[model samples]
Target: MSPLHLLQFFLCSVCIHMFSIFTYLVYYYDLFTSSHEAQEKYDFIIVGSGTAGSLIADRLLKETNYTFIVLEAGGKGHPFHDIPAFGPLLHRSVFDWHYETVPQENACFAMENSKCKQTQGKILGGSSKLNNMIHVRGNVSHYVDWFHGKYTKEYIEEHFNYIESNIYPLRNIQYDSQLSDAVLDAAKQLGFNELNHQNSLGFQKSLLTQNQGKRWTTSDNFDTSKYVLTNALVEKLIIKNNKCLGVQINYPKKVKLFAEKAVIISAGTFNSPKLLQLSGIGPAELLKSLNISVVKELPVGKNLQDHVGTGLDLVLFDTSQSVGMFDMMNFFNLYKYFVNGVGPLTTPGCEVVGFVSTKNETIPNIQFMVLPVGITADRGSHLRKSLGIADFVWDNYFSKLFEKYTTTFFPLILHPKSIGEVKIKSQDPNLPPLIDPKYLSHPEDLKTLVDGIKMLTKLLETDAMKTIGAHLNKNHFPGCEEYDLFSDLYLECYVKHLTLSSYHPIGTCSMGTDASQSVVDLTFAVFGIDNLYVVDGSVLPTLPSGNINAAIAMMANIFIENTINQFNLKTNQHMCSRNISFEELFLNVCPVR
Candidate 1:
């Protein structure tokens, strides 16, 4: 080859290398720069820019002329957060809140100091950015039971339809694993209906909150024109004479922001109540104990609920046939994912889901997720460490099973009977809330979980599962050696030691028509405070029978629609009255002091 030809090839190579470097820089810049500085005031001030806050801002900006500001406590999420398989990997990183429950008497027996680890997202998208992207609307019966007398079925249907239209498209993607197939076949043999989407019931491949193999967080879908203050922590609501004016934010410095129309707290279940209590709106006695003046007497953090379940590890004899975390982390797999956006990286690791009823025929009390790979017992592994599993707990029950290809059956109790509470440990706003989920405190919850374990064990005995050579490890847990393996007593002991949170906490600040039973009224306003509202999972009256993200998004959409309708009504009324001044119209609508 001539020197001229070789020089040409070298020039092309240099151009390709420069282009790759430029692409990476652009991606990093976009990923890290998703925050805007806080303004002095706006029409609406939304706290906690998680799932609901993002959607609310998008709808308000698009549908109305109102200007809004969203305050997020964490910075922009990492680019890896968009990878579906990295769902669990984001925890304990800067993205996760890393909140843990106070010591529990009835549950989390295997955890360090009897405290279960609670993970919440602190990034721009909130918990949605870090959550397993399983999109489920829950059973219709749950909605009917919770809102039957309160809301008409037509009203509920309208909200659900709106969510289906706007949010991530829900669809079941096929996996190549034989383990997923076996689980589905076992469900069919057990007489469960095959449902592949949100509107139906029974066992099916789960739908994910992904768009074309990428995790679609609320931040990704939010309108960019709206203002958002990242790394800004809301300390308290600015209330005067039973009316909310704005919020006091701490973005490494003190800043007071005013909202002309209303202040909405879209903080998740735990933080929402904590913020309310800090602002002197909660149970009067609790507020008094904290030495804060009582602004409103209501149950701010009374009914904390979450999905609790026992995870059973089943080892597969064929390790070569299954994919694990190690296999997915290699350079070849990374190249495949970067080039094609398809591989193990495209899945949330929860491929199949089954909803079942142990007692009530219409309502599904138990929900199961089938994970294809075995969870690690050491903190060295990214998946296990990110899950915040106690080191001792893993060593005692799961260390031995780490040698083979493993599949875990997560049997979650959908509607847990055990009710817990979130309370303020101190008056300081910077401190985390005292989260006591009190899992399995109710006797029925324990019995229901034990029944679920037995049901799964039965499923494992089926011919489909047998074809995959699935078998329970049967290794004795630390505190369960007294009873025989697979016995009810043994399983109950195992469950108490191994039950973990499904990360779907809700109902801290419940919404209802009656003020005595709820913190927020039917219109989502604080019972005694004016110009204040809450639009998040905290407003959920009861835990839905599936993943709470979709339901929370639906609730936010409905709330935004209501706000828009109210705004339009006021605007039309003002237009009809030519003599009405702008100030007078504002007072008539907001009435803020």
Candidate 2:
């Protein structure tokens, strides 16, 4: 409050504001300057520039002689995308696809029209550009089952390490908060142990896909100037004689770019399935209804899964105990962040994370994210609109806590029993798909989420929480006022009304040994299609124990490695079959070590 301090604050505010404007200008400049005609053909054609797509392009360019082109539907990324705290601000912005699910019968009860906003990144880095950048490498068993024993724990670990070394190593949040410390203490008080790096259960500071104070994306690992084509919206796959040979792009101008070797679809969970269905490679009945010719009869948009969770707001008696949005974005924090590369701005919303199990302690069913700021942190400015929360619910419930100092926790169901699917609304590639996660359709999924809520309520009663004077916000939710507040029925009603997607969508195009049930095989090749592959989250058969970005990167790494090995194997077989001396073979073609 002193004169010197006030003067410094004003100067810092001006500098930071100008810096933000500079980032925006830079982004637009890249968008305008980066558009040119792509090459006529490539060794491989990638349909997206998201987590999997970006990694695949970077790896292929660096590890092989093959040339590839990445077709992205979005524009270049902004520098704000590198700041962890600014993630939520990008949700409904131009950087996001802003897809929404259809009205649900059993869940998302309180949102507007009973629809949940599914925010997918439309920027160059894809969802990684807008996501919180939480780096969770989930349990190894998931890979074993999803790949049908083709990838073991050791193999998964090796590829995970490769991704870390190549892209960005995981780092803990540089900023510390009283709320994070209290959550950790409460977990210990409740008999939960600290989690090891490899364990999927228990409490620990979240490892993020960040280094220093900046976020890292798969796209950052490569040179976008040469490989990526921004604003290149792929309309459909160019298939001939049941083989995918190229893609038809509708952006910039209508053009066809062929693939010499293969066509890989890495356009995340929703768009990958949408692209396939548009190109005549999905369910027969759906294709027929739309009057589109069916290229393959296999299922393309079946078996959708996401980590569904609900927010729990806790108001603290002492304002200093919680870091409000103002406190985090103040001049002091901004100054520290810019000068020292460390501060509250480094927070990815969730500071400390915990995993708990209602059935067994070892296998956690719930993943708890400890957010230092409350849902009302922005006073319903951006969060409300970004989440597409109905105005009535916001006015009745969240608006009441606008001035309160609070912390919000998100308890996500690590694995849900409910299953849904993504289908094309029509044959049009420009339209967003019909995504119905069908959350809580299975009775067990609802019961399990309610159990997770109860566990969090217990954490509020812990002595550590008492020191911070933490208590659940008692304001009655708009549609859930019939049941007694804090009661089981009331919590269940609250959950149904306030359900949220953790942004971890997967399993729309699953892989398996059985062609009848899966879309891709062990080699990630399309079930019946030649030289076509799906190497993204869509191919994951089930949900992992935590955030799935790490798993997606691992899949891309393993796929490229497998492709290289296969090529080498074919070359070896062809050469060895001939009656040639080992010396001659080594001297001419295959070199000896």
Each prediction's TM-score against the native?
Answer: 0.89, 0.93
Question: How far out, in Å, is residue 408 in model 1?
Answer: 1.2
TM-score quality measure for candidate 1: 0.89
User: Could you give candidate 2's per-residue lDDT for residues 1-593 as a string of tens digits?
Assistant: 34643454465455445654665676578667875668888989998898889988887888788889998888786666677887777787667888999999988877889999999988888998877788877788878888778778788889988888777668887776888888899999998888875666789887888867888888988898788888888999988898999999976679999998899999999999999899999899999999989999887889999999987464444465545566666888888877776888888888887889988767889999887777666665566777888889877887667455667688899889999999997877888999999999998888888898888888989999998878888898888889999788988898899898988999988989887888999889998889899989899999988888988998898998888777666677677666878677766665443
**Predictions in order: lDDT:** 0.78, 0.83
Name the best candidate (by TM-score). 2
Candidate 2 structure lDDT = 0.83
lDDT of candidate 1 vs native?
0.78
In the order shown, what is each candidate's alpha-carbon RMSD? 8.0, 4.0
For lDDT, the strongest prediction is: 2
